[model samples]
Target: ALTWWNSHVRIVGNDAADVMTWIELKKKMADTYCPRNEMKKIESEFWNLEVQEESDRVERYIGGLPDSIHGSVTASKPKTMQEATEMTTGLMDKKICTYAERQAANKRKFEDTSRNNQGQQQPPKRQDVAREYAAGSGSRPLCPKCNFNHDGPCTPRCYKCNKIGHLSHDCRSPTNANVAKNLRGNGAGQKVTCYKCGAQGHFK
Candidate 1:
């Protein structure tokens, strides 16, 4: 699926939005940065020009607008993998600028809002934030039998009983596996003990 899609995006188009015409939208693209991830944004900061350069390089790839209707853009002379990698590093610097500008805008809104907990919340507790961005909600729920939340071992539970210890067929109760076929005549356990002579029969 992705191979087909990538082939399409790599095709160049002569449409107004494609080719070097996107240079017109450069300023807009520069301004159209995706804002900080609510959880991923860093509080303290350090400075490094090399890191900035790499960020700009990565941004070039992401900010690239197709020069053609089919969205394919290319350089006159092809580049080797090493050159492409270097270019990507420079684009990373640009990406940082884009995201930084976005974060600045967000800072103005939630600038003074106090954090709910003492420190930043962890990933499991950040589900609501994900939902706000249209990310799907988690499907986990408390186990009906053991009542364990995400803290319990991830044993497969029977959908009917909602128990995590075992599946419905292998359940110890007199149902399913035991009803028509108790081949060994043993219960759920694989081994059966003899009541007399301490000698066990394979199937009694």
Candidate 2:
């Protein structure tokens, strides 16, 4: 079975040295695989050889470029193989830059809107001042007669003199001297007692 497989193995290369190298490597692999574990190792090596061939094909398609372009094709850099190819070839950088700029502008707009909303939601200092003024004015003392503050006009009346514009405490009305005489004359028909001398002629 090994001899048939070796006979059927095909190599495509114009270089005689390369063809001889492949033949020798294949012969060594077949000779080294005597046990099942060694056979598994050989299979793994064949798989590795196939992967290397595919990698070489991809590298040939990408072509030889500068280190900068080569770095862009790495798995850690581009999002996909196609994107890596496009970036390496300078086909999509402009579009990517424009999209990034638009995204940044949108982010800035969102931040500005959030800031304005916060400012509008907060109460203003002038409103707080007005509220404090109203509360202070409501708590101040008012005049008893006019129900106004002290700054308002005075319109109080004096109860003793029955006069407007002055309180009873500051009244200047004089006492009437004819009050007793008028009372005696009005009570002429009645007997009034004089409490000073215990006589029944006039009231004290």
Candidate 3:
């Protein structure tokens, strides 16, 4: 609304009547000066149509008032009142939906508990299951530059070992001179000694 004012409403006219129809008002508010009489006509016509009042009465009322209030006081109605109605069973109000969601979630938990009670489970409990599937895991690390957490640890397999754990830096195979020269660590433009070969390039 303030954006409406700064971008549109607060430029030239002080009287609401001077702004005129919404479009005209918008123009006037946006640094274009509109005349008071023209705005009054549009305002009067708008109120008359909106409130189902006679045009004469609207004009008279406008003539009688000071021009501070730009928009009419006619209640804000939906453009299509009938179409705006959201038809739902009275049973499915906000309270009902909230309760339904909670109950469904709880039910899923209980069903899983019952299944796990009958067999070995990958995740033992809700918290374990949550952590297991969470975005932050071995797959995620806080940060690459530091120990900050991330979605998971890096998945780049060891270039030497072809395994998931350690990087090529700690692998048994000696580092390749070409690979060492090619490696860059941490971030762009960083320089470091390759831990594997002790040759400077960038590091893991």
Candidate 4:
């Protein structure tokens, strides 16, 4: 192989000397030593070669790209390997800008959500405040017998025993006549007195 290469270089002496770069040297060597059929086979393989994991060619190109810049790279429709590489190199600034813009938008959204939540935390309503104040401040005194808060006159009557102090459910006494009387407190036999005029049969 060495004898053949020397003889070939001698036959093409001036052409070999003209090889100024690595690329030119490689091209000259391939043209001289490589068979025409082998070159054609290698060219076929080079064009058809693909990444095993990635099925789509475009996806293979942009697979390593950040999501924010993927769309722009794919939209340019680069036709050659060199063109695609050039496009990616040219978009470095745009990729960074897009990523920073997305992060800024997310931060703004979080701040707005926090602001809205803070705004929604309103003061208590008038009725609720008044109810709490009345209960807490001893404005309406609690009945000592039943522990009931009352604004007017009230009797601690038990439904089960027709007596004072405990409610019907909490009455200690067994079932008796008073239990039946308490059940009939609002029955037809009882008088319906009007509080406004001290009258019966109709409400004031």
Candidate 5:
């Protein structure tokens, strides 16, 4: 820059030098380094530039850039290519962070849903089943045959005859001890089996 200034700017006459300004200096430099014909040729090349090959480099990088990055950079209206690249990098980082957060949230939701389904699928306890059968009685249901809070089949005891393996209403024994005593005194052997001793002609 000093060599060009000394050779081109310093040699002007006193009257011509008086009229020279910074803008005039810049225009002279532009005219010398970038001629009108060369500028036109560069413009033409920029318009014709394509990314047909993987290793192409254009003077205007934005012209050959992919739409995804180019559109974003253009929307931000960056004044320079460096600013556009920085914006692109920041956008990608923000996108990655949001995706990671969403993935973590989805994973947590899936785990919670799985736990709920497992709890729902568990079999009910025996006492819980009995309570449900009780129909809001707030207690376990009683077995009709045994009249007790139990589940499944059972050998019932007779309330009337004081014997096991049968219900009171189905007992075949005499109704009371007095009836058996009267039958015995009259010598009437009814051939009934005793539930206690398994012997005939007696009742227990």
Candidate 6:
């Protein structure tokens, strides 16, 4: 009869229907005085299978954690799915905050270094100064005596005319001309004497 029942039983698509059919089959076998030890063995196998499946699911979830903090989470050695999930979440939050703080500090340090470099004064190069002068942006050199810009080379001033670029000895003033005329003619009509050569003809 059992063999006929097993042959007639059709495989079902619904999980609940399959389970019900299995329970019915087990009840029939029990009624036929199946050994109790065999029944216990079957129940133990089902329990072990369920436990193995749950363990695999939890391990896969743990493996999915971020690699950066994966070691830290694993080091915690969480025993359950819920513990592992909670620990990973907390560690990730802390790591993110720490990274943000480090980035902010680096930004501030860079800004300070930039500001310090800007504040430090650098001496102008001679070439750059020459370039500026050539570009007509630089000021001309001032004359120490006149306190004015001198376009040409600074030279002694003419005492008679009080003008720069010519010496007093080369001055074309009227006073020097008068002195020359007086030296050339004595008041008494005597011949002018050359002071350097002691000659009676030309004045030195």
**Each candidate: how many clashes?**
27, 0, 15, 0, 0, 0
Model 6: per-residue Cα lDDT over 1-204, one tens digit each: 656455435444345445666678677667666677888998899888753565676677778887987888778877788888899889888999999999999999999999999999798998787555555632777655434455776677775556677766777765555546657665777666554344566655
Question: Model 4 residue 19 lDDT?
Answer: 65
Sorted by lDDT (best first), the order is: 6, 5, 4, 2, 3, 1
With a 3 Å backbone cut-off (N, CA, C), the pairs that clash in candidate 5 are none
- Which tens-of-lDDT digit does each residue in 93-162 have in candidate 2? 6556888999999999999999999878866697687556655676566666544445557788765445
Q: How close is candidate 3 to the true structure, as a TM-score?
A: 0.20
Clashes of 1: 27
Q: Where in model 4 is the C-alpha error above 4 Å?
A: 1-80, 90-96, 116-121, 138-140, 143-204
**What value does the lDDT take at residue 173 in candidate 5?**
70
Whole-model lDDT per candidate: 0.47, 0.59, 0.53, 0.68, 0.69, 0.70
Give the poorly placed runs of model 5, Cα more than 4 Å off.
1-70, 122-204
TM-score of each: 0.18, 0.25, 0.20, 0.31, 0.30, 0.42
Query: lDDT winner among the candidates?
Result: 6
Better of 1 and 5 by lDDT: 5
Model 3 gets an lDDT of 0.53
| Overall local distance difference test of candidate 6 | 0.70
**Candidate 6: regions farther than 4 A off:** 1-54, 137-150, 154-204
Candidate with best TM-score? 6
Q: How do all the candidates rank in terms of TM-score, highest first? A: 6, 4, 5, 2, 3, 1
For model 3, residues 91-128, the per-residue Cα lDDT tens digits are 13654778899999999999999998889745478766
Lowest summed lDDT across 10 adjacent residues in model 5 is found at 53-62
Over 1-204, each residue of candidate 1 has an lDDT whose tens digit, in order, gives: 355334534664335335445564554444444334522344323322243465455446434633331122234221343455555555556768888999998886565454544366656646665444332323455554433444356577664344567766656643333333545555676554332222334322
**Model 3: residues >4 Å from true position, as ranges?**
1-33, 51-99, 110-119, 122-204
Distance from true location, Cα of 153 in model 1, Å: 76
